[model samples]
Target: MSKLLKDYLAKSLQDKKDRGLYNEIQILDGANGPMIQIEGQELVNLSSNNYLGLATDDRLIKASQTAADQYGVGAGAVRTINGTQRIHQELEEAIAKFKGTEAAIAFQSGFNCNMGAISAVMDKNDAILSDELNHASIIDGCRLSGAKIIRIKHSDMADLRAKAKEASESGLYNKIMYITDGVFSMDGDVAKLPEIVEIAKEFDLITYVDDAHGSGVMGQGAGTVKHFGLAKEIDFQIGTLSKAIGVVGGYVAGSKDLIDWLKVAARPFLFSTSLTPSDAAAAKEAITIMTQSTELNEKLWQNAAYLKEKLAALGFNTGHSETPITPVIVGDENLTQKFTKRLYEEGVYAKSIVFPTVPLGTGRLRNMPTAAHTQAMLDQAVDAYEKVGRELGII
Candidate 1:
């Protein structure tokens, strides 16, 4: 390696450490469920995105194993080649059905789905209006498209409408696309899709929603777009198979023409290897299970409400979240990290979000309560929160 490159890497890492922005990853000894073991210490985990706790579901595991037995492991090629197996097509069909769309196309991961989908449809001649707090993947995807990017205020409908009107009237671009997260991962705020759809209709703009954190947790497991009854109105409904679906992959569900265009124009689908046989089969089974029953989704909301009530009653700012994601706000970044460490020591494993991920002064401990978590686990978590919070003078 070059000495200059090595020095630059060292300085950048040190700068991150000084700013308390460096993340120290934790290792889980087993599956990411309600409870997890890290460094031989079992803790009530609240940091994972496994909202419905489907990651370790026996049915999903069995489906994956069965697929492995039948088709081996990997898909062996990209979707345009021999990689497009029966399971892949079936999963895509399942996604379309679940999302209430005309068709769907799958990718290896949600990030790639965003990277491929946005670039596939919009280009330098286009303009994308994105939410200020949208996920990194969406931002990167927009950049990749070489479009003129306009950032709208987070959940501010007025700002969106004004921007939409201004951009449309300017007529500087061939097309304008409005994109947002169905559920903002950091604050757990649901996007105003109904209003967004209305604005899109009024301005004749293309609509896209990245429902990565919304699938299996909203709209009776359909997603946030369906939560507001705008499934058919939105042009693109993007989601992930890795989160509540409990597998690995991402997809875009939309009209038949949109999906056909994605299949041919999306570079990831055309170039990257498709999801492995087990992952695809497991994802399909998971979606089927969700469509068949809302038991898991209900439990997820129940746990979320319970935890939020407990934390807020204890005087912690739970933030303005409408979904199962609970954020315990701590203003100082260093203190937030310390609070997380203290909670871990007391047997709860919730991580702190700081700058670049969220606004600098709004550092928080984000808790993700899942369907598999029990009352006892929640009570124990509350106890740990109280103890650590009181000790740190945060509550």
Candidate 2:
């Protein structure tokens, strides 16, 4: 390596070590279900985004296997070529039906979908009014769009309206778009979509909602757009199959015109290979499950409510969450990491979020309660939390 790179790497490693921020990765020996095995010890899982427990569902697994057997492995070429398979079209149709959109298009991953879709529509001459705490993918997408990005205060409709109006009245941009996360992943707060839609209408701005974390947990599993009854109003509805859908890909649901435009213009969709037959088939099955019943969604909410209540009663600050994503606020980064380590030792696996992922001094332990977790499992996890909390003087 060059001297500069060597020095930078050495300093960065030293800095992490000095602050006790160096992370030791642990391997999950098996499936990421309600319980996971780490270092040969089984623990209650609280760090996954498998909200509906569909990641290991038998139907999804069977679908994937069947597709692999029928269609072989890869798509074999970029989508612009002849890579698009029948399963790809089937998956898009399934997603459109689930999201209540006229049509949908899939990308390699949620990150790419954001990058491809946002940049494909918005340009340097436009302005994007985005929520302050939107996901990293949205941030990257806006940056890639080369749009004048105006960040509104998190979930504050007043701020959004002010900035949007200013951007519109200035006439400096060809168009204005308001973008936000359907569910704030870190804090678990739902976006104020009703107010946002009203603001977007007033300003004549396009509305985009990235529902990566909302898709299998909200609106009886439809998503935040459906939760707020704005399915047709929102211009862009982005979702991830890797999370609740139990597969690996991302998609954008919108009007037929928008879907057609993206299919032609989005770089990732055009240049990158389409999803594997197995992944596409599995995602289609996941959508079918969501459409068929609300059982998983109900179970997930029940577990989330129970966990949040118990944590609050124990004096652990569960941040302003309206979904299954729960955070145990511990201000100091070192203490937060230590708390997570202790919890793992006590047979519960939760991850620590510190600076960079979040802002400085707002370190936390994020817990993801999934549908697979039973009441007995949750009770055991609560007991472990109590023991670890007392041991660390956190409660």
TM-score for all models, in order of appearance: 0.99, 0.98
What digit string (tens of lDDT, one per residue) describes model 2 on residues 130-163? 8989889899999999999998999988888889
lDDT of each: 0.94, 0.92
lDDT of predicted model 1? 0.94
Worst 10-residue lDDT window for candidate 1 reads: 14-23
lDDT of 2 at 162: 85
Tally clashes: model 1: 0
- Going through the candidates in the order shown, the clash numbers are 0, 0
User: Cα-based RMSD of the predictions, in order?
Assistant: 0.8, 1.0
Model 2 lDDT on a 0 to 1 scale = 0.92
